[model samples]
Target chain A: MTLASALIRAHIRERLAAALALPIVALAASSIAMAGEPVTIRIDNFTFGPETVTVAPGTKVIWINGDDIPHTVVSQTKLFRSKALDTDDRYTFTFDAPGEYPYFCSLHPHMTGKVVVKAPAG
Target chain B: MHDPTDPNDDPTRPSRRGALECMVWAGTGLLWTLGGGLPRAVGLERALAAEASPAPFSFLQISDSHVGFNKPANPDALGTLREAVEKIRTLPQKPSFIIHTGDISHLSKDREFDDADQILRETGVPMFYVPGEHDLLDDEPGRAYLDRYGKGSRGAGWYSFDQNGVHFIGLVNVVDLKAGGLGNLGAEQLDWLEKDIAGLSSSKPIVVFAHIPLWTVYPEWGWGTQDGARALALLKRFGSVTVLNGHIHQIIQKVEGTIAFHTARSTAFPQPAPGSAPSPGPMKVPAGELRQHLGIASVSLVHGNEPLAVIDTPLAG
Candidate 1:
């Protein structure tokens, strides 16, 4: 084979490798974006378990009241508020904005929790 | 200062000292008698066990409505509260009024208060209220309760009013909630309570009502008031002092000197006896038996009665 022909073939091979790497990189990025899942905060014994939680924006946050007494999930900034939740009751709020939502049990002010929402990767 | 009638020691046996002390304070002190349209009463007996009462006025006590509560312990709390009202309406003799110990609502929401009012108002009797831990919730500390019932009340919703012949003082002890523990009646309220009662004659009958138990029912669940002893101290001089409370959601009675302490049952649900459950909360009972454990308290005061006649009749009966 001629040396010029050999160089051209090598160039073509390099181009093929580059094309293959682009999709693989794209898939990795997509997977990372898919990692966002629902988060939950447990209310038991007059406290918010996992007092702080961080999640991607649009992630649903759920509060389950395991304590015998009734409780409420109310946001400090009026972002979200749940009705009085009795034992084993559940309240869900999907945080869409990228910011912090500090919450507490309206029935018990000392019981507090926070959810940190992060922007999703493109 | 020795109070055997305090039934806090033993309801089955009324101590001789307590009976004698009661007779001394209640019996020859004054000839005044309570008047109302009630049945006849027999002469006084040594033990307060006899139903006979010196004063003819009767008042009802209801507590812990938890109107917003929708738990398994008692899903139909409002219905049960209505039932309690119905029971009160059917009494052979109408009670003068009702004094709620506390916990009118679970979440202290505006609708919760409205719901409770609708049910309680049906009984056709006025009700004096005190705040509970659940009533002074986050976002707004006591605004809902105070807006609805704070008129004529002192700081934090504590107030005193005069009935037919008795003085009723409502104390608020839930402004600051402890973490799953005991309640606190701040010094400010204590001082106000002191001055409020300072002018009353020692012979005048005093009836005090607060949400939490004035006595130490159990410290683990914050069942008792932190400064209840201080409030009770000032009330000791009165001839007939009845201190009734309702946070515990169960019936427990005691007597110390001239002061008689009683905790009434909740209209919404029942809590485990002190230390019976892992913690104090809504105690789930078997089906069809919840009403058996919940009821209102009726206090009978005769002008010179010692150890006011307290009757706890269940909603079912």
Candidate 2:
């Protein structure tokens, strides 16, 4: 092959390789998206804003108490306990297991909320 | 009026006068001891304490029990809550009613609610409740809480009633909470509160109860109500206003004008003070003092010509 043709052939091969890598990169990005970032729940007054949260396993659930009073981010199934958060306090716990974690304010037994952890789809 | 020369007055001139003076002195001493000094002896500091004993009308304020919680601090919160009820049952004076400031169930689950109900019902005291953020975890705000305890309340379990010359208001502030926001008493509730207290005379005492603190105890952990000022303003006209809350799980008291805000301790577990820990969570104490740190608040009402004295006694056991 002539030098010019050989160079073109090499360039095409490189382009093909790059094209093949795009799918792999896209797949990785999508998986990361599915895994989701940490979910932040702001606890104030007597209820959790964004009462129902959807996240994936390995996602960290951060509960921030912004009320002037203290509160708790307690899981229904005994999954985790953020003892009692005072004003501007925060508690973060990762959900490695996939399931619905319901919680309530320990101070006010009537106050309740939940977090749902989804598993990674195959 | 008898002559001094008579046997009654002449022989011992000081006899009758001295005897009468002595009798008068003894009478005065008896009055001071039995009538005036008895109240003081019993440690009655305020003038109103002399009126009458608080006719045994008491109510329970159980806060931050954090049911549905499992941790080293309190492995079985529901179990401990049952213990608290047992303690209440053994009280010399059983409270006529119970008020849960918030956090009735940890997870807002049917089972959690069921467990809390089973445990709480053991007390046999009529219970009233306000929602905590955890109680509003469902898709709808306070759906489970309202389903169980929000009867006769307005939207989201905010309501009011009259008992023993006091106006009691239960407010819901956890709904529509802002980002990085403290507790919120939305406009609707604010209007309602204003109207609720509008008709009451200034002499009438008002008790406003909620799950979040109406005053700023700590802002970082959302300890104060976002629009509590508005609520206080409505209560300004009242002679005595007591704002009771439970989300803090600790005892913090503040008085503003006619208003007094008190945050009660959690029966479930104790948390560190604001900024004490990196974040707010259960603080494990020695097993012995756990119950002491966490207990119920007893508010006794004695209706008389004076302001109601709310004496808060933490659970000793």
Candidate 3:
């Protein structure tokens, strides 16, 4: 093969590799989006299950009351609050910022939990 | 009126051991009567005789009527409450009025409150109430309770009423509870309490009732109030002070100087004593033994220097 032909082959190979990398990057982006899928914290027996939850930023968190009694979800700093949740009732909140948010049930204050939102990986 | 037995004479300083010992004795069939600031445990026969006798004016106290609770502890809460009211109706001497300490409803739902109201009204006795945490679980947080029972009450439904020369103060301490803390009366309610009894003479008999125990019974289960001490301090100057409460679902009485503290049992169900269970909730007894744990309280005020006589009558024991 001549130098011209070899140069063309190299360019084609480089272009092919770049094209293959595009789908891999796209798959990674889709997975990152999936990372924000909703998380659940169950309220049962006057307790918050899993007590503490860690999720990525922008992830949505849901609290479902499983006890026969009513409960409430109120943030420590008054950032978010849910009305009294009867049995099987649900409340949803999204953590958009990377920080620690602690909350408790206003009705039964002993039931407490925390949410830790992690920064996205570089 | 100060109890010479209590050296400190501080109403706020209660002995937890004394409270616990009293609880154990409560399970027996004996009834308690407070005379001259001392709780005297009498036989069931003598207590019945005392109840048959007359006094200046007697009132009934029914607490924790969780009308909507359908748990295994007691499947028919409303039915049991009706039974309690039935007992009230059949009393030899009808109560002048009824003082319901709190937890009138289970979930604070409209139907729960309605059911409780319907059953309690059957006795045809005027009722006074303080809100429990369960009664304030509505979406608006205590709006349902206040709307129905807050007529003349101030700031979360705390109010005072003069009944037969006794100054009755109904306090609200279940609102604005702090996280990981017990019940709270808040600064606003505390200020209101101070002024509510400011003009009353020290000799005037004061009866303070609230849902949660104003003194620390057990903090692990959130049975006590965080700012309850502040309110008790305000009442320390008064000679004849009787603090009645419910939420523990059992009888635990204490006497410190001129003040006497007592917690009434629930009309619906019973709860494990302080730390007996993993947590605090409806505790189920064996079959045919549930009534033994549920009951009502009757208090009699004799016109004189004699302290009020509080009688706790279980549904069955």
Candidate 4:
């Protein structure tokens, strides 16, 4: 084979390898995003059902208010806040940090709930 | 109008004086008879005061409502709690405040607290609370409870106040509860309690309310406070002290060194008396009879010329 042809063939092989690796990286990233577990929170009446929850960091949490009353998901540590969600309304927040986060309804001081963020599982 | 000149009147004057002295002696005897039974009469008066008093002031004692609880014992715990509040409203005398001993909710759900709050607010009386093991099931000793009902309380929801010449204290014992471990007051609260009570004179009446029984009611089920002895020691100097608790969900009274310890019933559901069941959980009775088992307590204090009397009346018969 000619030396120029050999160099061109090598360059094509390297380009082919890079192209093949790109899809795999994209696939892995998408899988991680999809693999994130969803934390479910039920809100009924004047309370947050399950009052306390334990979730892994980066988990997406969905709070559905099923009660006739309105509620606010305000974190005590100021981790996050979901503005007033009325009956049948839904709110979602992602917890990226691992710590104990206590929350309450800004409207009803007596309505309290807690979220426990745990380290990601190995 | 006396005729002093008459011989007959002069002779009768000494005799009249002697008769007056005899009447005075008779009156003294009657007064001694009444005074001899004064203590017993006062005791009887207290018993009657507990039974009947016009416009008496009382504070409600509610414990272990466990709003989110749906165990076999109580399917509708919140319903029963509402019934208890209804009973409180119909009470002849409205309570001045409501003191929740603990376990206000079963799962410590925000909804449970909401349900409990809804029922409690119906009473039209201010409410005071302490934490229970069920309330502090979260990692942060149930910060939600503190944020809502624990205003003006010290760390972990302990505080003291004075009402009608009585020193009222609210203590927190469930902060570091272990699995199947008895409630604990920890050292810091004990220190605070000592300092809090140090300034009060022994003559002042003291009422200490907490979630766990300061006295060992049932050690097997972890119904007692682990460090309650230290707390009691600080209160020993008071002439009349009352220690109130609620975790056991029943009435258990003990008197030690002039301090009376009483546990109130849960407005939500009933638990079997310590060791009566396999574990401490809701106890279901017939629907009609559930109200009889679950009731609120009204504690009244009468402060007049008599000693302070605390009367605890159950909602049910």
Candidate 5:
């Protein structure tokens, strides 16, 4: 083939690869932004690990009961509540607003934890 | 270890000594008499022979059945409970009634309640009930427990009745618990308690029973009632007051002033002693030793003449 034709074909191929790569990178970035890291509050030994958590609004928070006994996540202000969570059972809630949410295990009320949800940076 | 010089140890409070005496009596299989508010350790042989002469009236205390619990600590919770019931059935004298101080079910399932009721009913003695945190685990909180046991009971299945000249009050303190606190008897229940005991003369013998220990046992394990002192204050006027509780699943007896507090063993599994383990959960024992950790309680009242007697009998040696 002629050198000029070969160079044109190589340029076309490079442009096509860039076009596909840009969307793929953008898609990955958007997905990461849309679904932020989910915060987990573990229930173990009748206590909540990290007793307090700070998260951005719309963050999904999951509570897993790792103790042999059952536990529950109940909001102090009656905003959300969970059914009894047996061993290895999980309950999840998403915080969509900026507020301090305090919760505890209803059965073992001494176990308490707080979630501080803040708005994204300006 | 207990410090004898601790200010918290009131001079008149001889709980440690009393408990030791009680253990000595129980160890010998002797029944002591509590007469005129004083405990007199009867001779072992006479006490054994005196079993034929039963107390005026007595009731059985069975607690923490946890019927639906199927764990390594105890895979057959119901089987142990039935064994406890059989012990009750074959008692030398039939108890006037039975007091089940809660945890009738593990997950608050209807089937668990039914199974417990069927097995417990074989004793053929009337029963009084108060709920435990485990029993209130239904989708709607205490719906399952209340539906079956709330009849004629005031808020959360607390009530009072007079039997054999002794006033019996069942208090419910396992609901509406506050964050960072232990068990709770909210203001409403406390109000009911005040009015319920009003008009009764100070000489009246009072028996107060609840699911959780009315006095502080182990706050770290959530084994105490937040507002229990208020209730005790109300009962302070009585000449003789006995408080029976069962959530801790072990026998712990304490006598403060005129009031005597007793916690009973479980018909299900055993829990670690306060601060004995990192956390208070079921303690798994060897399969053959499970029954040694589980048992029942018997409370006797010799009409209005004697101080109350509580006998704790284990299922096995």
Candidate 6:
């Protein structure tokens, strides 16, 4: 083949590969956005399910009261405290910085859970 | 859960209403006791002949006003509580004092406390209060409640006083609780309670008032006290010991010889019956029926054979 034709062919191939890679990169970006999405934790049967949860900083965490009685979400270090959450009620807190958070139901002291907030994963 | 009716249940881990149901099936009422050194369920015969000797003095118990609670179950907790206060004032016989079981506010806010205090002052009788879980939900632990009602109370707001020949013990059980659990009387308070009644004679009439039920009403709803059994043991020998509480927001009476456990209905709103709902939260009864379930507990101290007689009067009829 002529050198010019070969160069053009290679150029076309490189452009095609870049075009295909664009969607792949976009897909990965969306998955990362999904990773930063809010997570929900269930509080039921006098327990905070998934008692230990790890999430990226800035991710919002929601706690839903599934139990019959009223409950409160109080952080160990005074980080946050929710009002009495009745049945099906919810309390949301967004972790803005990385730290370990241990919390419990103020009403039912036996029901406890922890949250681990970490820097956004690369 | 600390159900006295079920010996099989674990003292630390209380079960469902199964034990309470058992009390019904056994032909014995859902009554648990703190009479003698042990706990047992008693019957109607166990009821002291309260009328045998006419009552000399009386006290009122009102609780859970939740002044800021604007939820559907009670749009105007303040209004209902006002109704309760009116009922207290119009009692057939004036009570010597009033004991508020607790939950005086919904969010422990200054305004809520203010509203509760403003209205409660109308009773024109001295009122004793022990904080509820709701009352302690402020920025500082019990700072608001203590500021308003903790005067002359001991550590964390617990105290004992004598009135009309009856030893009244106001215990603070909601200071430190288990995670999503019931009320707790820590070691310090327990110690104080032990010494408070150490010198009293067996014939002395005693009255214990707290925010949560001393007996296990329902574990699932955090209605009982974790260390209540221990606290109650000290009063077992007294001939006329009455335990009054209010957290369950319902009327439940039990007689165990001289020690009678009675939980009063809330002045604010009604919660679901034990195990009647999916969970224990507020219940929105038909608008007109609210008064039937929400009211005050009037306990009469008749200088007679019976130590105390508790008559629960609803807000309406």
lDDT (Cα atoms) of all candidates against the true structure: 0.74, 0.69, 0.82, 0.68, 0.82, 0.75
List model 6 lDDT by residue over B40-150, tens digit each. Answer: 544534433323443456667788787888767778889999988887787656777888889998778899999999999999998888888888877677898888898
Q: Write the per-residue lDDT of candidate 3 for residues B184-226, one digit (tens) a residue.
A: 9999999999999999866567889999999999887788899
Deviating ranges (above 4 Å) for candidate 1: A1-41, A45-64, A71-122, B1-55, B178-181, B303-308
| Estimated TM-score for each candidate | 0.68, 0.63, 0.83, 0.60, 0.84, 0.75
Q: Estimate the overall C-alpha local distance difference test score of candidate 3.
A: 0.82
Superposition error at B170 for model 4 (Å): 0.4
Q: Arrange candidates by DockQ, highest first: which order?
A: 5, 3, 6, 1, 2, 4
> DockQ (Cα-based) per candidate?
0.16, 0.06, 0.45, 0.02, 0.71, 0.31
lDDT over C-alpha atoms for residue B118 of model 1: 92
Ranking by lDDT: 5, 3, 6, 1, 2, 4
Query: For candidate 1, lDDT tens digit of each residue in B146-192?
Result: 88999998889999988754678999877654433356789899999
| Per-residue lDDT of candidate 2, residues B247-285 (tens digit) | 777776655655667677887888789878754567788
For B188-244, candidate 5 gives per-residue lDDT tens digits of 999999999999876567889999999999999999999999999999997668888
Off by over 4 Å in 5: A1-34, A119-122, B1-52, B303-310
User: Using alpha carbons, what is the TM-score of model 6?
Assistant: 0.75
Q: Give lDDT tens digits, candidate 4, residues B190-289.
A: 9999999888766577779998788888776567777998898888876567788887776665555567677877766777876676545456677667
What's the residue-level lDDT of A90 in candidate 6?
97
Q: Which structure is stronger by TM-score: 2 or 4?
A: 2
Tens-digit lDDT track of model 1 for A88-113: 88999987778988877644454678
Query: lDDT at B67 for candidate 3?
Result: 88
